[model samples]
Target: MSVTPEAAARLRAYLAYFRDLGVHEFYRWSEPAAQALEPAAAVEAPAPSIAAATGVLPPATPPVVAPPLEIDDRELQPAHMLPPSLREPPAPALRSFDDLVPLPATTIPAADRPAALKVIQDEIGDCTRCPLAYGGRRKIVFADGDPNTELMFIGEGPGADEDAQGLPFVGKAGQLLNNMINAMGLKREQVYIANIVKCRPPANRTPEYVEASTCSQFLIKQIDVVQPKVIVALGSTAATYLLGRKQALAGLRGSFHSARGAKVAVTYHPAFLLREPRMKGEAWKDLQMVMRELGLKPPVKQ
Candidate 1:
């Protein structure tokens, strides 16, 4: 049967959902054999006394026939799109950043990194690669700051302010981030910044696994081109995707992780700091670890 465009779109969504759940393969079940008319059909029939008692069996009764079952293709197509909750096995595992894609064969020379990053951006133009494209994202907030910088910051995803401006970190959280950057004795333009997903999730919600995984390819490429000496993962979401594991932020912080040929440090997102200002000290500690690696020191007060 031919699938209409609308139906095909829905099918794609269902498939994406299942793919995120880690169900890559599906198999068709064969139809069950028709049932017998008599309950004793399997019984060794009392020596077939009644029917075979005589060659003259009473006109030989015919076997009952069952009608074919009608199924709706619309409802049954992609029948394996069941929720993971209903399945016996756990959902598919999340892949870490390194597993998402390999680094480019060769590093981009410092002089060419800008143009190299632009190429990746152009490839993602008007992207509809994931559900986020349709989730009311006004603009795609690509990476900001120096392409050749040795330090990069990765956030969860775009927020409303960033989505509207097509630039990362312009809102209140961004302001806090700017302060954090300054505290590290660096200018905003001296460091690169990006997010797990470019497009903003609906209502600024965290990105879903499918959305993050789909959008992160470009991010991986961005990381490769920039080839930062260190990447600071801001928040649990960023850490989850970068390190490719699910762990509490408390544990992930205060230590160095690795991703895409660079050292990774986990910290509280600026947004999180806004909600819990007390944690700013802890976040600063994480940044200090990054600073020490880069040999950076806070600026002297006037």
Candidate 2:
């Protein structure tokens, strides 16, 4: 019988799943297959070869898996053949997960968070800390959402909708962000939101380095108060300031960097996403990493 393409895909998918589970050796497949593609690549492009999809080659070192319990497959199963408990799968051996994720957010008492955040806002009142303050903006867009959240999003600066509303992330890009958060099984209010510069930069250009640097202290203070477990730096400007240096978005993305005692994941800004929708998948992958740390499950596919 001819192997259907669908069957081939399912088989390869199973292989990849097993490979990650530490099952590298499959009699019918080899390691060359899994080497054809990388998980991070899968986010950027179409799926690769089946061999790559299904990791067939076992690791050079035996993976840390459940103890190898020998089981006889000589005959059909029967209750009389083996105890029910014996048929159970073994627990996986412990593996070093030390660097896999950041420590979970230290829980801040809800009652104290508001008062603490208020202190920062009060200090920022009628701010003219930088040239950004003269950018024809009527109000300062400080932030939005909960101060007690374990997740926070820091964007480059406010846009028209945000500046007019005196709130961060209330524009078309904000809508996209809302969808992104919903995909991660979270709400706009569940996570705190802020910006590198409280005032909108002229014509929505990148916040100038000096403006970003001047206002970053307040942003840093806000982060210190919230102490979110993870902070998503939207776009390169946000990343540069949060990470304390200039870096290509590509270079800065795809991993967690420690910033202000929190884990940070850098990705394209929502405004950029609106312009280049194809990159949304890549952005989604970044968010998934944050979700994993927060133990959040994505919304079910329709």
Say which candidate scores most in lDDT: 1
Q: Give a tens-digit lDDT track for model 2, residues 1-302.
A: 22334445665666666666566666354465444322223236656668767877445674333233443443346546767675656533321112223433564577887887888889989998889878787789878898888999999898898888999888899999999999999899999999989998889888776687678667777787788889999998787767766779888778898886788999899999999999999998899899999999987889
Candidate 2 stretches greater than 4 Å from native:
1-108
Candidate 1 structure quality by residue, lDDT tens digits, 60-157: 66654433344323333343675555445655688988987876688778999889999999999999999999988899988899999999999999
Inter-residue clash pairs, candidate 1: 96-244
Mark the regions of model 1 whose C-alpha exceeds 4 Å error after superposition.
Answer: 1-89
Q: Cα deviation in Å at residue 228, candidate 2?
A: 0.4
Question: Mind sharing the TM-score for model 2?
Answer: 0.63
What is the C-alpha RMSD, rounded to one decimal, of candidate 1?
12.9
lDDT of 2: 0.78
